[model samples]
Target: MSTHSRTARSGDRAASALAYGVVGLGLAFLAIPLAITCLMALDARTFLGPLPPPALSLHWFERLASRADILSSLRTSLVLAVLTTILSVSIGTAAAVGLARGDFPGKATLTSAFLSPLIVPPVVIGFGLLLFLSKAGITNGMARLLLGHVIVTVPYCIRTSLASLLGADKRLTEAAMILGATERQAFWSITIPLMKTGIITGAIFAFAISMDDVSISLFLSDPSATTLPVTLVSNMRAAFDLTIAAAAVILMAVTVLLIVVLDRLVGFDNVVGQGLFRS
Candidate 1:
C-alpha cells in the first residue's frame, strides 16, 4: 500500500479505538453506581457505608420484606404500571391508527398535540393534573395516579405504533378487504397482527415509564396510594440507609428482568433501529 493509504488506515483505527474507549467509559459511569448500590444492599454492616464491606449478607433484603410501607408502595406501583400499560397501549394504538391512516385536515396538528405531553415537563404535567382533577372532584389518589400515568405513557405508545404502522404493508389490508373481509375484520386480522411488535414495544415502554415515574406520582399519590418511587424519595428525605439500597436493588432487579423480557420479545436493536429508520 502507498504511505498515504497506510497513514489513512492508521488514523481510522485510532479513531475507532477512541470511540470504543468513550463508549466503555460511558457504560461504566452508568453501571458503577448501580453496582455500588447492590453491594451496599448485600453489606452485613449495621450502617450504610462504602461497598465491599467487612462481610456480605442478605439482612437488608430480609428487612426490605418486613417493611410494610415499602411493600404496599411496591404493590401500588405494580398496579398503576399495569393499568397504564393497558390503557396507553389500547388508546394510543387506536389514535395512532387514525392519525396514520386518516386524511383529516388538521392531521399534523393533532399528531403534534397528542405528543405534546412528551415535551412538557413531568412536574408541570403533574401539577396541572392535580389542579384539574381536584377541581373536578376526582380526589381519589389511585385514580389520579392512573390518569397521570396514562397521559404520560400514551405519547410513547402513539409514537411507536405510528412508526410501525407507517412501515407496514398497506396492500395486505386492501387484499384482505378485497377477499370479502369487512373493515373491522381486516383491521383485527391484518393490521393488528402487523402492528403487534409496535404495540408490545409501546406497552413495555409504558410499563417502565410508569414504574420509574416519581415527579408525576408524587403529586398524585396519597399516603395510602404511594408508589415505590415516591416512597423511596420520601424515605431518602427522612433518612438514608442501607435498607433503601436493598429496596433499590430489588427495583433494579425487576427493571433488569423487564429489559430481558423485552429483548426476548423484540430485540432492543430492532425496536430502536426500526423506529429511527421509520421516523
Candidate 2:
C-alpha cells in the first residue's frame, strides 16, 4: 500500500477509537446517578443523610413491608404494566406489520400520525387526554391511566415491531402461501413467529413505561388506582423519607431486570436504533 493510504487508515482508526471512547464515557456518566441512588435505597436512613447514609443497611428494605399502601401501589403498578404490555404489543405489532410491509393508501402519512405520540411531549398528551376524558364523562381511574399509557407505548411497540418485521424473511410468508397456506395462516405460522422478538422487546418497553409512568398517571390517577411512579411522586412531594429511597431502588431494579430479560430473550442489541419507525 502507498504511504498516503497507510496514514489515511491510521487516521480512520484513531477517529473510530475516539468515537467509541466518547460513547462509553457518556454511558457511564448517565449510569452513575442511578448507581448511587440504588446504593442509597438500601440504607437505613438514606433521606436523613447526604443522599446515602455513610454505611449500608437493609433496614429500609425490611421496613418496606410495613407500608401497606406502598405494597398495594407496587401491585397495582405491576398489573398496569402487564396490561399495557399486552395491549401495546398486540396493537402496535399489528400496526407495524400493516404499515411497514403493506401497500395501503397514504401509508406514510398514517404511520407518521400513529407515531406522533413519541414526538409530542408527555405532559401535554396527558393533560389533553385528561380534559378529553373528563369531557367524555370517563372517570379518571385505572382505565383512564391504561388508555394514556397505551397511547404513549404504541410508538415504541410499532417502531420495534417494524424493525423485526423489516428484517424478517419475506419469502417465508410467500413460500407458505405457495404451499397452499392462506394469507392469515401464513402470517400466523410464519410472520408471527419471526416477529416474536420485536413484539416481546416492545412489550417490555411498554410495561416499563406504564410501571414508571408519572406524567400521565399523575393526571389520571385516583387514590385507589395509583401506579408505582405516581405513588413515589406523591410521597416525594408530600414527604421526603427513607422509604422513598427503597421504592426508588425497587423501581430501578425492576427496570434493570426487565432490560436484562428482554436482552436475553430477543437480543436487545438487535432491536435498538432501528430509527423512528421501528417495531
Candidate 3:
C-alpha cells in the first residue's frame, strides 16, 4: 500500500481501539458494583464493608428466607406488579390505538397528558396520589397501591404500544376490511398480532417498574401492605446486614432472569430501540 493509505488505515484502527476501550470501561463501571454486592451477599460475614469476607457461606440467604416480613412483602410486590402490568397494558394499548390512528383535535395534548407520569417526579406523583386517595376516602392499602402502580406503569405501555402501532403497515388492516372483516375483527386478527412484541415489551416494562418502585409504593403502602422495595428500605434503616445484601442479590437475579426472557422472546435491542426509533 502507499504510505498515505497505510497512515489512514493505522489512524482508523487506533480510533476503533479507543472506541472499544471506552465501551469496555462503561460496561465495567456498571457491572462492578453489582458483582461486589452479589459477592458480599454470599460472604459469611454478618456486617457490610468494602473488604470481602474470609470465606463464603449461605447464612445470609438462610436468614432472608426465614424472614416472614420480607416474604410477605415480596408476595405483595409480585401481586401488585402482575396487576399493574395487566391494567397498564390494556388501557395503554387502547389509548395508543386511538392516538396512532385517530384524527382528532388535541391529539398531541392528550398524548402528552397520558405520558406525563413518566416525566413527573415519582415523589410528586406519589404525594399527589396519596392526597387524592385520602380525599376520596380510599383507605385500603392494596387498592391504593394498585391504583398508584397502574398510573405509573401506563406511560411505558402507551409509549411502546404507540411506537408499534405507528410502525405497523396501515394497509394490513385496510386489506382485512376489504376482505369482509369487520373493524373489530381486523383489529383483533391483524393489528394486535402484529403489535404483540411491543405489547409484551410494554408489559415487561410495567412489571419491572412496579416491582422496583419505592416512592409511590411507600406513599400507598401501609404496614400490612408493604412492598419488597419498601420493606428493604425499612430494614436498611433499622439495621445494616448481609440479609439485605442477600435480598438484593435475589432481586437482581429476578431482574436478570426477566431480561433474559425478554431477550429470548423478542430481543432486547428490538424492543428498546425499535419502540423508540419506529415512532
C-alpha-based local distance difference test score of model 2? 0.85
Model 3 scores a TM of 0.92
- Any idea what lDDT model 3 has? 0.91
Error of 2 at 136 (Å): 0.7
The full ranking of all candidates by TM-score, starting with the best, is 1, 3, 2
Ranking by lDDT: 1, 3, 2
Q: Across residues 1-65, which tens digit of lDDT does each residue of candidate 1 receive?
A: 99999999999999999999999999999999998888899999888766579999999999889
In model 2, the Cα lDDT at residue 16 comes to 100
Winner by TM-score:
1
Tell me the tens digit of each residue's lDDT in model 3 across 23-137.
9999999999999988999897667766767889999999999999999999999999999999999999999899989999999999999999998999999999999999999
Question: What is the per-residue lDDT of model 2 for residues 95-213, given as tens digits with 9 covering 90 to 100?
Answer: 98888678978998998998999989999999999999999999959899889999999899988888788887689899999999999999899988888877888888898888888
lDDT of 3 at 231: 94
CA lDDT, candidate 2, residue 221: 86
Error of 3 at 172 (Å): 0.9
Q: Please report, in order, the local distance difference test score of every candidate based on alpha carbons.
A: 0.91, 0.85, 0.91
TM-score of each: 0.95, 0.87, 0.92
Candidate 2's displacement at residue 153, Å, is 0.5
Candidate 1, which segments miss by more than 4 Å at Cα?
1-3, 274-279
